[model samples]
Target: MSQTPGDPRHALPIRLNVDDSDSPADVVDALFLGRFANGEQPYSHSTSIERVKPGATLLPPAAEVVRAARDSDRSATLAQGEGWTLLVSRWSRGADVTVTAVSDELAEKVLREAVDGAQDEPEPQPENVTMGFWYVSPRRGPHRTTRQIAAGTWAEVRPNYTAPVAEAMDRLMKTTPDDIAGRLLLLHGPPGTGKTSALRTLARSWRDWCQVDCVLDPERLFNDVGYLMDIAIGEDEGTAKGRWRLLLLEDCDELIRGEARHTAGQALSRLLNLTDGLLGQGRNVLVGVTTNEDLERLHPAVVRPGRCLARIEVGRLTHRESVEWLGTEEGVSREGATLAELFALRRGSGPASVPAQHDGADAGLYL
Candidate 1:
């Protein structure tokens, strides 16, 4: 028997002795492994797609190469051709397909044919960008969910920032993949100072070359070794491969504050490791963090030289800019206003009032 390079099946036992105590599922799995032990057909190809088109079926196309077919819920199909096997499984959000064949070329061809027209092409929405959300579920452990979010281009939202911040953002918005100098992006500011808004636009500007994902629960992510490893090691599916990924962690004040070493223990160290240490090696990943703490209050390790791609302090607009933005000085203050205040004033409320935060339930996830 021959074995393909890097294939884990090479470690399996040459023969299996199943006892009566073995469960049916275990016996079936053993039998399945037995068929591949000979290594006659060692080539394999696999891909996963998100947002599978509605009403699309994989069974029909899978039948093109195989004689026998088995399907369930019209969403999963399995078929076998001479010296080859194909499997397609789909759920509400996405689908995964895999093919194993005697030759690498055959495996690739079968996979391509099975999913030729099954994926849903993302429609053009200039105001929207697709982002991934990562969180640890009680039942499923670590999981990622993709969503299309509404976000404006930097030009449309330029007036929301002060001059200096706007200038810095101008350069950031125009950044290409080649301009990436470091692994971490730090955004620190007041709660209502448009930090999240800036991140959303950043996602839009870098959409062509980067994939953005938000870790919903940052505290749990770093504290759980298993969860952290799952996220750090997982590969982006389909066309997202080879693209840089920005993992956005919001409101992480406790994790990066000056006292983080005493408070967060290994959490802070793990975060730094993921940014520029051994864990980040060979992984095209960037960490973007939004914190309410002032820059001086952040841990020194997080702000040291050469570790950050950008360290932006998102602040309130100047008084003049606020007056100009509102077109009237009626509710504007001499100290200027945050983006949330501006929105509140526009809605007929006073500048002191906070606008309702967008939870993104109806318009998709934001921030």
Candidate 2:
């Protein structure tokens, strides 16, 4: 329960810049941010991260970058940028904000404004309150570089999906506020659209909802650390929750890479049983896994009626959504193109875009 600031035992650091170009987002030691806001204190006893809104924006470092713009009384929507990536929002105060995929241009702008001031358009408000404000995303690992993906990499994909993105987030992040409110909630989304970034906020929301011990993310493990068959066995007798908590797995498809192998087989079995609610104390054990893959790929048993219990699809974004959000982030001189447009036109029908194709993607877990 006691972990020093440098104690890797409590908060292990993943490699920074896990993949080329991508940083912080992939390396963070997935944590349930809900409790962070309640003043539960961070796992790192020595180093205390400033508490800001989940996804607040920082004004560009322009000349006279006042906290509040003179003309606009509304505590100027916050905006922060690194390179081309830029995250814009205002936190609800006393929340920890960690924005990712910021652009260097925005970075320079922030710096310039920090020293000087520039007249530009105001910043954007949240798509909704649940979306989070004042991001606090840092480097994913010790070696990972800082990023602002929510600002840069993620583009809107509303047109791609039949449901509203904000609604999806609400349904995903919002639960009954049960005892296990901090349990895992899986989410799936296409690449370059913002799955990891969304989870960042989800983690924050989870922490905000309940007094959680730790929020564990399996996505980064699957990607960088690979599937540690050990975790498949279920959590140890001791955990932060003291009883049970959430464990999120993003892009679970990656776990199926070696289904034929003995280790993977055991791993798959462990996942199936856990998802089926066969293991762990049901009191507060909630498991969520998101995949671009279809349900067929997932073991029927795992995703079946009672196993997964709840399954939701994160569809592609509409043309308009892409244009509006990305347009704002990209600072498009002309606004007509959409995120769906860019995804459709620029990229091919690759596996990343066609997540539904991976249907039964989590099927193996049930099998």
Candidate 3:
């Protein structure tokens, strides 16, 4: 972390003109005249990001910008205001904006006040069980842009699984970062077997203890330096719980397949590093990966017994489990059904009638 005498060259007066739809990135871009970098560390290494909290009025998108900056291993202050200073730094994962002030009051004032702009009212906070969704930017990668999905609770998820599997998932949800022995969580099974649905419930249940952010392009996560850096280092700015984060990487069979080391090269190694190697050390981050590949087919390093906190296979529900889930003793056969199929049936539609819905709309993964 470099600290200059708050040089005048870096002082930027804010001119905020945003509404509810605008993100903090938009605000920074509007003021800085370009995109604000994401995944940058703009604070001293000793500067504990855990203590940094966004004002209650700060929008989710803007909160992410600040979080990315503080999570970085380096520092770069871009501008300074009367009571606050703006930082733009790069992390191995991404870069982002940060506002630092001499006092919490000044920080809140600088965060909430928007000169030359209308005040965007804060969205009402939910009473209980709030879940947030984030995705990688298609054009710029995961660190660049993010949006919140609709809030949901575990009650909304209807994934049908065997009793033991369901109970295991519930236990995992209740487990905190402190309880896990390893940093990686591997959820694998056949497609449409409720892998994603169960992940949603886990995210909702663990919201209080950890910040769950998804890597939209899991295939690119290890291959792309920026994407990997962003997800691995970008701590959730909203969390006051020190360094707790959960990274969700779904449908990444190609990245962790048996032949990945021979084909994907460093991708597999990078994923492993994020799991429990040097990169994962000292960061209270957990990596959750979902794949359709069989457990035996995953890279040996990935499936090694001690390498994972939990290695659960999300198979399709059994005949009895499906009957209980569907509430049809005779209508549905005992062959069982996947969560997707059950969802389709619940909608009064056949399995084939499952609409080509986007990821989050039906499954609650996309916010």
Best by lDDT: 1
Over 4 Å off in model 1, which ranges?
Answer: 1-47, 60-91, 95-116, 137-141, 239-241, 353-367
Per-model TM against the reference: 0.72, 0.38, 0.63
RMSD each, Å? 6.2, 17.7, 10.4
Residue range 1-367, candidate 2, lDDT tens digits: 4545765444643322346753232222122222232223222111112233334233333322212221221122223232222222222232122222233343344444432222222243343211211111342131111112121211342233334655666565555455232333445444434455455555445544432222244433433322332333334322344333445555677553333234354555555544443454344555556666654555544444544434555544454554444443232223333233344333343322233332232322211
Local distance difference test, candidate 2: 0.37
The full ranking of all candidates by lDDT, starting with the best, is: 1, 3, 2
> What does the lDDT read for residue 211 in candidate 2?
25
| Residue-level lDDT tens digits of model 1 in 1-367 | 5556977766775777788765443443344334456576678888777777777655334354323233332244556676677666555667767777888998888778777787787886878998889888653478787888888989998888999999999999998889988899999987678888889999999999999999999999889999988888877553267898899999999999999999999999999999999988888889999998999999999999999999999888888898898898877777888877777787675553333563444212212
Please, what are the lDDT tens digits per residue for candidate 3 over residues 157-200? Answer: 53466667777776786787668898889999866777776776
What C-alpha root-mean-square deviation, in Å, does candidate 3 show against the real structure? Answer: 10.4
Q: Give each model's whole-structure lDDT.
A: 0.78, 0.37, 0.60
